[model samples]
Target: MEDFYPSRISEKPQIMKRRDPVIHTDRKHDHEAPLTKDQLDFYEENGFLQIENLFSDKEVAAMQKAIFELQESNSCVQSEKMIREPNSNEIRSIFAVDQDDDYFKDIAADQRLLDIVNHLLGSDVYVHQSRINYKPGFSGKEFNWHSDFETWHTEDGMPRMRALSMSIALSDNYVHNGPLMLVPGSHKYYVSCIGATPEDNYKESLKTQKVGVPDNDSLKWLVDQGGGLSVATGKAGTITIFESNTMHASTSNMTPYPRNNLFMVYNSVENKLVEPFAGAGERPEYIAVRKTTEPLGKEKILK
Candidate 1:
């Protein structure tokens, strides 16, 4: 497959039009929780969809407890799966949450999520990455603006924009806190950032990303093109699904409220990863799964 979306190999940033669809699915499904037609239209036009109160209070509480347990667990705190803040011992993110605990694993395999993923990608999907992000009060840092597809293609070798992000709010995301902000229609374009990929870049980028980030001019242009930026603010149990190429970021939390988000990124089975488009060695399995390309379930649905 060709590298349709390339990044981090030039001295000047390149703004290229996206050649992929925002929503890849087009078929009937028995998914009780499938996105409605209006929701599908919204995503195709805006690159994101937010559904409030999708999960129940009980489910949200359960996940919250699981997160606290994982945070207190010695194994997560002592392992490489944990990503700390730049200087402090604060846990910025816990990678591969689905692999770490049965609670997360069950949530990952939940039929509603799986069915919706199937409807979105038009195929059975597998988890490309999973993590729980924590932004403690007064200490959470910002995530700079960038497209996940750009990094995935350049570093992780995701050949196409057939992937999407499914993030559930584990805590109330407020304006005062570092809630996610996304460009409304940013997935229509790709930003080819200017930088050289350093060796073991994931080690640093997993905490703070410098390379593959959109430049100021490019961000301005995208905002103009997208109409404006939209903040994802919702109570716990709110669910958001966005295109993989959507331009999104978060601010540094200075408020007393902590914002925690659980991410389960799904990729089309047909769009499985390959060698890095930047011509480097593959990243670790924990960052990007390469060994297992199996479909979400035992077999492909909607085939």
Candidate 2:
């Protein structure tokens, strides 16, 4: 495969102008999408959009309940899907969460969210990845700044920058509780990192990523270009949507409050997986999601 955004083989980082389109569709007035022209325009300029209350309080409560049940069930504790904090047993993330949980599956298929994704991708989309991230007070760790597409493209064989992540806050995300921080226009530039991916890196990288991280210079450049960092902090039920290549990260939860969010990646059906650009090979299905590419809500769910 031709590698437009190559990494993991170079000894230095390179910044390449983004070659792919950020907005795949021209029809901005999507009835079910609920995004106005101004909102779409902002996303086009910034590569991310933060909606204050996309989900209702009742809906947020139900989502929180579902997550509580999942945690109690210990379904992912023994599997690779569950990523624990470096210092504690508390889970940092649960990968491929909807594969076994019907509640999350329904959330993934929910028309209210899918419409916006469909409009953005300009095509029917499928669940490329899904997870719930937990940041417990005091023990939680920092997720260093990096672009998710950097890892997904190199290790997971995601072809183009045609994917986007939709993260819905499940609890109050305060400025001090390690709220998500993103560089507004950073998605337009792809930072190719320097490092060879270790074999079976997923086992370790899930907790603290080392291979696909951007260098400090590149991060600073993005920040400088964007003027400063923009944070996503709001009450439960808020939604933050961003392009796959957008630079984002969160700090450790040092305060008493906790931050939890449900993250789902929607990939255009046209931009499917290929051979891995780096690493041992294709990552496990839990992380990259190759088996089930069926469009959510429209086609039959692949088992």
Candidate 3:
């Protein structure tokens, strides 16, 4: 494969470091007591945790309606493409909803969510990436395992910086329904430079040692080494949060029902959006629907 590694963001003087304009360090929203000592300890130890009932039944219902609408529109578009291209990687569609829309504004600004974010990050955290995953008809597709930072752009030697993602299910999640699988506490072992080879074809060379076995064997060994894959399963309103460095992916949805989930990515104000990857055009809906109450710098909000 051709080398596709992205160039690093240009660095500036040490005295005046440049940061992502979209990230803001201001705590505009009212913050309750951030993370209690126990909550912090819990996150530090476990790579992931489940926050049950993040959304109410009503909210979930509304989201379900919106998701179906989006899916219907997507199906029509893909169907047309199918006429020309018989083979396409477009087996499924995962959309980033409008961040500035009523759904996102309400959910992103939900005091409960803000409280949890404040707990994980400090009071001045910013909502970075918010998207919806819509898999139709038990598609035999999965989100391949990868680290978020690998796809990001930043000055060399920059800190990992606090980041978190909340995956909220809009339908009952199960192994068959493609519940997310996470390796426990794996983030602690992550290194910043996970072998900076070609971007798209980059394998996670950051492993401490070579995984000598075959794919299934290595996965089994990994499960044994990391206490096993955490299959987060639950009802529509449950949300699971984890560190950005945590290793995670999902299996093919095999159930008759569709699997839909919303993802909200959060990062500190200092993290810059790596253009072409994290910028608005990559997913315009995500950038446009963002509704922040406080000063968040020059973020690419999806309105």
- For model 2, residues 145-178, the per-residue Cα lDDT tens digits are 8899989998988889999999999989889999
Q: What range of 10 consecutive residues in model 3 has the weakest lDDT sum?
A: 13-22
Query: Against the correct fold, how does model 3 do in TM-score?
Result: 0.65
The order of the candidates by TM-score, greatest first, is 1, 2, 3
lDDT of 2: 0.86
Q: Rate the local accuracy (lDDT) of all candidates.
A: 0.85, 0.86, 0.51
Pick the winner on TM-score between candidates 2 and 3: 2
Candidates in order, TM-scores: namely 0.95, 0.95, 0.65
How much is 230 displaced in model 1, in angstroms? 0.2
Candidate 3 C-alpha lDDT tens digits along 30-80: 233444445455566666778776567888898888766755656556431
Error of 2 at 27 (Å): 6.0
User: Distance (Å) between predicted and true CA of 123, model 2?
Assistant: 0.4
C-alpha lDDT of residue 200 in model 3: 21
